[model samples]
Target: MARQSLAERRRQLTEAAIRAMTRDGVARTTTRSIAAEAGVSLSVFHYCFDSKQVLLESVIEAITEHYITVVKEAIRPRATLRETVRAGFQAYWDHVHAHPGEHMLTYELTQYALRQPGFEHLARRQYELYADTYTGLIEELGRSMDFELRVPAPTLARYLAAMTDGLTLSLLVLGKDAVPASADILDTITEHVASLVGDEPARQSTEVAGGTA
Candidate 1:
């Protein structure tokens, strides 16, 4: 068999860890289990990661990367700020529905990281990553719309991140039947973002009309 490159082995092991944790629950997951899931020997597990904590950190990195990709696709350039924000929320919720296991594993790993000694930083770092991702998106939205946000970008991003976390937990517990109602909750958030933009859309329209006259 061909030898795997260092990066490939690490990626394989990390994915295996995520699958094992999702299947067996975080507390019950072990290096033995993760190695088995990766189709490698126990020594390979150690070779790939210094410790289980390191492995978990890799998992967090993978989760954060995936989330950024998901959210970027959702919030990609749109014709209007309102539509852009709405698309982001809708795309995220759709992802939750499509990959419930992945989302569930993220939350599970977060709680696990918090309770584990020397691992609490992972949880904090995860939220920081989330805030940064959303903040960038909001800033991009403002640039695309030719408008400025009334609130600081970081502040608004953190607020939206908190709302998403809460809403995700609620949806996970409430199941598919509750998605529609949860959407209404998202609409409330959208309205909040809209309020921060004030009359930028109207002002832009007036500018266009004056320029064309």
Candidate 2:
């Protein structure tokens, strides 16, 4: 087999680490185990990731990207603005349902990070990544749909992030209890979020009609 580049090697190790962590709890997973999962030597794992923290961070990012990538695609301009927004949210919800274990591991990783000395930063970073991802998506939706925010972008982003986090955890914790209402819940949130946008063109049209009257 051809040799892997450093970036490729790190990507391989990161994917392997995610599989290991998702299968085994974060506390139980070790570099040796990740290397074995990736079919590489322990030394190769260390070479790619000098510390466990680095590997875990990569896993956090990879998992985030894994779900957000679907959302981004789902958010592509549909015929209706509300449809597009709802599609994005529904896509994320679908991911949570499909990969419940991965979502559960994210919460576990957060708790693990907070308990480990000097590793609290990882938990913070995890949340920050969520907020940042929302911020980007909100901006993208605004640009594509042509609307201004009723609130500050960051405020709206963080609010959405918090709402998603709550809903995801509720689903995971409540299990089947949340299943019946899950789609309806997501639709309600999508409507509330869509309503939070101030549509500039629509407002201008209404103002022009009033002026003519």
Candidate 3:
């Protein structure tokens, strides 16, 4: 195969690291194991990342991006506002359902980071990414659809992130057998969230055009 750029190589190793961490827990996964998982030499892994901490940071970012991309696409102003909201939630649920191990790894990474000295910031960054992701999605909807938030965008974003975090954790704790029941709860919460917004009148699209005009 041709040579991979440093960015490409880092991405390759990061993906491998995610898989390793997901399968073997953050505490169990090591630079050597990650290198092996990527089918590259340990020297190459060292060259790409300064330390395992850096590698973990990369994995944190990559995994967050992994799921948010799906939600972003899912929230693209669907046929109805409620449908759009449901799609975003469903997209997130689908990811957790399909990759339970990957989703579980996120919680593990957070706990691992918190317990490791000088690594607490990683846990903070992880949740911050969650809020930031929601902030972007909320803003995207504000720019596209007709609605105003019940609270400020940042507030709602964090709330959504926290709420989803709990929901996801409950799913993991309850196991796959509770899938049907969780869907009911998710649907109720999604509708309640949707109800909180969408009270304002007219298209958010026209508001932007009128302002920029």
Backbone N/Cα/C clashes per model:
0, 0, 0
Report how far off residue 104 is in candidate 2 (Å): 0.6
lDDT of 2 by residue, 132-207 (tens): 9999998888778867688898898889889999989998898888889987998899789877875555678888
In candidate 1, what are the lDDT values of residues 1-213, reduced to their tens digit?
A: 899998999999999988888788989989998889999999988888987777877887887677667777777667777777788888788777777787788799889889889989888887888898788887676666666677888898898889888877777888888776866877887788777764467677888999999
What residue pairs clash in candidate 3, if any at all? Answer: none
lDDT values, one for every candidate: 0.81, 0.89, 0.87
Candidate 2: residue 31 Cα off by (Å): 0.8
**Model 1 reaches what TM-score against the true structure?**
0.86
What candidate 2 gets wrong by more than 4 Å, as runs, is 200-213
Query: Which parts of model 1 have CA positions greater than 4 angstroms off?
Result: 197-199, 202-213
Tell me the spans in candidate 3 whose CA falls farther than 4 Å from its real position.
199-213
Supply candidate 2's per-residue lDDT for 203: 72
TM-score of each: 0.86, 0.93, 0.91
Worst 10 residues of 2 by lDDT: 194-203
Best by the TM-score measure: 2
Sorted on lDDT, best first, the list reads 2, 3, 1
By TM-score, is 2 or 3 better?
A: 2
Superposed by TM-score, candidate 3 places the C-alpha of residue 172 at a distance from the truth, in angstroms, of 0.9
Error of 2 at 115 (Å): 0.7
